[model samples]
Target: MSSNSPADPPVRRIDRVLAFMALGIAVLSVLCFFAIMISTAAGMQHADYATGVWPIVAVLPLVGLPIAFLLIVALLIMSIVRRGKAGRS
Candidate 1:
């Protein structure tokens, strides 16, 4: 019933952490974006967005998505390096 083969590379903790972090950030960002969209559709004023936590909600997607992209890129690089090393050895 085991699916893993001997040739399969072991998963690293950092990889898992990075992937989860990226996913979580991306999901949260999207949810925030949706919340903004829903609020706007419900007649939220521009002045409201500038106030309090609304600004933070509006900014999260802008900042979070790029960070998630970077995390994904880093994860890819790490996986590639690990695979190359494993293949060579």
Candidate 2:
């Protein structure tokens, strides 16, 4: 007897890529923020932030989080549109 269950929808490559990209950016941003916090807790000087990679570390979460958020929104919209199209067909 043939199974009557509907087949699962295939995940698009773009969706996978966007998801991973958002996750990677969010994780990296959080790690950098934590590193900055740890360094400050350890008595890192203000001047030290200007001299090395600290500036980038401090800025990453500020920028990365918003970008990641936008990417997630885009991914969500894409998913909704894809599902709508599939349902219509």
Candidate 3:
């Protein structure tokens, strides 16, 4: 007896390639954001110890938010396209 119930599709090679690309982009973005945060913190500490001055608290979102938002939009578009293709089949 053979069982057949429209078995789920295996991961396609293209999907794997795209996944790795997405992962690499995400990791780079995160590392960049972390570096920004660390540098900003170090600057503040240095200012306090030297001149006793801590100016603006605008670093985390300034560089990180836009980069992340753009990536999210890109991923959204990719997913929508993928979904559209799957739907047609």
Best by lDDT: 1
In model 1, the Cα lDDT at residue 87 comes to: 89
RMSD of each: 1.5, 3.6, 7.7
- Give the per-residue lDDT digits (tens) of candidate 2, residues 1-89: 33443533578899999999999999999999999999999998889999778889999999999999999999999999887887888
**lDDT of each residue in 24-85, candidate 3, tens digit only:** 65566576566557877667454453332222223433554566566566666766777677
TM-score per model over all chains: 0.94, 0.91, 0.45
- For 9-89, candidate 1 gives per-residue lDDT tens digits of 899899999999999999999999999999999998899888889988999999999999999999999999998998888
Weakest 10 consecutive residues, lDDT, candidate 2?
1-10
Candidate 1 least-lDDT 10 residues: 1-10
Task: State residue 2's C-alpha deviation in candidate 1, in Å.
Answer: 7.1
Q: After superposition, how far is residue 89 of candidate 3 from its true place, in Å?
A: 8.9
Candidate 2 displacement at residue 72 in angstroms: 0.4
- TM-score, model 3 to reference: 0.45
Candidate 1's C-alpha lDDT? Answer: 0.95
Candidate 1 backbone collisions, by pair: none
Candidate with more favorable, higher lDDT: 2 or 3? 2
Q: Where does candidate 2 stray beyond 4 Å?
A: 1-8
